[model samples]
Target: MVLKRVRANFKRFIKSNAKGQTTTEYILILFVVVMVALKFRGLMKEKITSQMDTLGTKIEQITNDSE
Candidate 1:
């Protein structure tokens, strides 16, 4: 039946790729992290480069009556 073919395929896959499973998982995770970093690099740069009125500065200004 179809179930037998599926099971056979599953077994074959498990046997063939099991050895490199950890390395594969790590590479996949690293790829995802690199992709996300690349995607957000511009946004992070903007946040860091911003010189005005962040939350901490605002709080300090209010406390010191400089606002």
Candidate 2:
């Protein structure tokens, strides 16, 4: 009887564990996405800055040519 009870408990434990595994997987995926975003943050900033600089240069040239 004790063995049967233990087996039943084990089955419940496994079912609960399966639910936890999916949440754990999602958390891991979120962590990886955050890490990747952090890793590329500098590159993204540089690209945006470079684009802004190019735009500023074009605007300055247009103003100078008008004058």
Candidate 3:
């Protein structure tokens, strides 16, 4: 599922004489990370909202106790 089209302009990155991963590999890795984040955005948002709601409830409880 790699975007081969994006690799054409990345030939220079592949010309590395070293054995480690090249710039092209880094780009592909970042693309995968972005894709994963996009896929899980809804779940992440839900978790964050739930956490915030709990925190707000706790704060309200503390305020009531202090009063």
Rank the candidate models, highest TM-score first: 3, 2, 1
* 1-67: candidate 1 lDDT, tens digit per residue: 9999998886777578866566667888999999999999999888876754486787797889963
Q: For model 1, give the 10-residue run with minimal summed lDDT.
A: 49-58
lDDT score, candidate 1, position 57: 88
Show model 1 residue runs off by greater than 4 Å: 1-14, 17-19, 51-67
Over all chains combined, what TM-score does candidate 2 have?
Answer: 0.54
Clashes of 3: 0
Q: How does residue 65 of candidate 3 score in lDDT?
A: 100
TM-score of each: 0.50, 0.54, 0.72
Ranking by lDDT: 2, 1, 3
1-67: candidate 3 lDDT, tens digit per residue:
2678667545644565343356557878999999999999999999999999999999999999999
- Measure candidate 1: CA RMSD: 8.4
RMSD (Cα, Å) of model 2? 7.6
Q: Which residue pairs does candidate 2 place in steric collision?
A: none
